[model samples]
Target: MRIDGRARALIAADDRGLLYGDGLFETLRVRAGVCPLWDRHVARLRVGCRRLRLPPPAAGALERDRDALIAGAADAVLRITWTRGSGMRGYAPPLAATPRCVLALAPAPAIPVHWYARGIRVRFCDVRLARQPRLAGIKHLNRLEQVLARAEWRDAAIAEGLMLDTGGHVIGATAANVFAVIDDMLVTPRLDQAGVAGVGRAVLLDAFPKTRVRALRRTDLERASEVLLVSAVRGALPVRRLDARRLPVGPWAR
Candidate 1:
């Protein structure tokens, strides 16, 4: 995809993101020409930059650039990527780095009206995310694990796939964070070791203060009263089935 004001055929050859997947990205839902969670996304991007030891760009400048990119789209998915820019021939980060930021806008995926009403089916993926506390809860560019997991299923019958960590703990879905209702309590996986803390998850937790974040096992998920997959673009989707286990629709599932 083209970035900035240029039509380069490919991403910069020397980009650290290309070399080592050293970058952070945010996916935001654009509704009616406005990004509702723009501030929160920007906050997370800034925090990710700090954690990665990268220079933060001017907020106004970045917003202006992003707005220009999405000005034509009525409803779209806005993705902003921040990389460590070009680097020398080594793993060591450069002392004087000019961070590269890319803003792109694309059409949002069409959501089936019936799927939202009847809930969606999901399956457990075999790909296990490696535990890395340092990178936990951040939307980093290293997504090979998710890419692999998503490829496991080609059937249109399955809507999403839930993922677990190496420790066999339920972390999240392939492309979204998971939340479930157990014993009338809202529970979601704690992203202390794996998984990206999704922006939609943050909004739900903030909206419902009683929601709890904790480590969940496979058994806990199976016994949950309701399961929901959440993402910035998809909002909250009820889970109908996971693998061979069939989950019944409940009031909480709504």
Candidate 2:
């Protein structure tokens, strides 16, 4: 782990990321020592920094740290986290706070190959995401809601759980983005109200010209011909069952 461009494993106890969840994090897939989706991660990080009023580190600095951590790794998960530097007590941030950047590399877990071929089953989470447009679409460090939602299930057969916004609109799953195919067109929930706008979702939207971004209801998902769960690390997995409904693993998923 590299903290603020230095090689270290310890961070200050008063660090804003620890004291208060004032930070942002990006998780990218490192393949053969190279991150294919680096640009997208950086782009999303910048958006988070801008929204959170945190200064972003130099692009070159981040790349250097990432390269150093991923040295010679074949396949790994690289995480870059930034927090408002240590400060005094209370929620009001210091005026001239320096940002802290931490980067780490971990071995990528082996995913079930059959999940991609045969599809995976998912469940609807009881936890509803609170609508916060200011924090929406960014991979921020404040993920207690997700933590709670993930704990709602203990079934190993369920690959992911779908979540809805406080207003009852389908947002996404615990970690990945959700998409449904209807009438030969792709539809994904809009992040303007809630949910993280993921890099894989952006890739899919660009790849499929018929993609549409808007509010999605549970009925919309039930009526769709196919459902897909996408993320930078997972790539794409077809959803064969959502709740008690069985969805088709269509050709588009392949």
The number of clashing residue pairs in each candidate reads 0, 0
RMSD of each candidate relative to the true structure: 1.4, 0.9
Query: lDDT of each structure?
Result: 0.88, 0.92
- State the lDDT at 15 in candidate 1: 98
Model 1, 1-24: lDDT tens digits are 336544343577999988998889
TM-score of each: 0.96, 0.98
Residue runs of model 1 more than 4 Å from their true location after superposition: 5-9
Instruction: Give the TM-score (vs. native) of candidate 1.
Output: 0.96
- Hey, what RMSD does candidate 1 come out at? 1.4
> Best candidate per lDDT, number?
2
